[model samples]
Target: METLKGKTAVVTGSSRSIGRGIAERLAARGALVAVHYATNATAAQDVVEAIGKAGGRAFAFGTELGHEGDAERFWAEFDVQRRAFSDDGDTGVDILVNNAAVALRDHFQDATVADFDRMVAVNIRAPFFIVQHALDRLRDGGRVINISSAVTRLGLPEVIAYGATKGALDSFSRILAKELGSRGITVNVVAPGYVDTDSNADWLRHDKDAWEETAAKSVFGRVGEPEDIGDAVAFLASDAGRWITGQHIDASGGTRM
Candidate 1:
């Protein structure tokens, strides 16, 4: 019923995969969505086109995160695009989804300093500064949804650094909720287990034995789809989730349950 009829949303790393799912769902719910991409303009444009084809509105923006001035550059492009698209040239946004991240699969001893630093830069540092810089542009009663991982809860040793970064994001969401509560802004985390994305296509979709083993992790006895997490994010971004904040929702299809 177009709950977000006039709202504007920014979803980072939405060129493809789970982030694209969230952006598409938000657009379908009648929000003006800005689909942010790092290096894949074509993929981002494809997502925007797909949303448009679905009778939704979306635009693409490019900004490489995890670098110096990354947040500033992203906002600069975002402001320009938003103003161009807004009917009254308003630049304020109602939803900010931090879904951009890097996954490095390495054990504690095998992980290099460069790998750790890069993960920290993309996963932890970027979101922190993005929120800090976006506060002014984010209106009262806005939603801040951070995409996290089930690895944080499962303590998977392969992606120790990756899990730690998401753990930090969850903590950040809790504290940020309190800080922004007075402004009526809600902050929360949506943690997903192994979803069948291209990133995991090799193991989860291609290899039959690997797929079966992976699916067994969830009590549902199946792999979680991108839409599963996307729908959850959509609910949290909607007004129906007004009373929900400072929380972590496991959109993992009962993984490890």
Candidate 2:
């Protein structure tokens, strides 16, 4: 049942939300998960504790992404923990999930330079360098999965800047898949539609009419859950998904159908 019995995984921005879901799902499959957080150390630790109670293995690491030298600091801390987790030589990352991102409600007309720059930093730039830095550590036959958004696929101009970054991420992932294929490393992207996360609680959970409207967007008659995306990632990170590199998987549960 433990498909990833001895594998190691690092999920960025995993202190909560979709990242938390991915970390938990990976741990469920017997991977030793490194729960990476930006600033919420307590939240990250809570995830670790919860995983422990569930009979899974995990640890917490903190580093603010999208800043100078963040990728270097991140992997250094990861190596330290990987050493403590086992005696074998650090094999780098078996699974790397880039799930951290900054989203602001800005349209093309409203998006400021600050908004564009911040989103680009965390959503695109951080993952760009993080993976660049991880290449050395990412073991052969490893998996690199990037979390994306439905905005890129849909004409959601409400978040022009945010959507642009995700589009770039899609391009970045596909190219990596091609390049890393020779080394047996798989790179892919997952684009999620309106999920039921804390981030959407206000409109999707509290507003009755808004909840109905969002649910109607999905043919499933319900909104996607964080676990839905997590399970999808788990499959792609598994041995069964090795042959599926450089692909964009729509995990939106038939959104806008």
The model with the greatest lDDT is 1
Per-residue lDDT of 40-130 in model 2, one digit per residue for the tens? 9999999999999999999888889878898898888877876776778764679999999998888888889988988999998899899
State the lDDT of candidate 1 residue by residue for 1-257, as single tens digits: 68888899999999999999999899989998999999999999999999999999998889999999999999999888777766577878899999999998999989998998899999989999999999998999999999999998999899999998999999999999999999999999999998999799876688999999989999999988878888999999999999999999999988988
Candidate 1 regions exceeding 4 Å error are: none
> Which predicted model would earn the best TM-score?
1
Q: After superposition, how far is residue 62 of candidate 1 from its true place, in Å?
A: 0.5
CA-lDDT, candidates in order: 0.92, 0.90
RMSD of candidate 1 to the truth, in angstroms, is: 1.0
Which whole-number lDDT from 0 to 100 does residue 107 have in model 2?
81
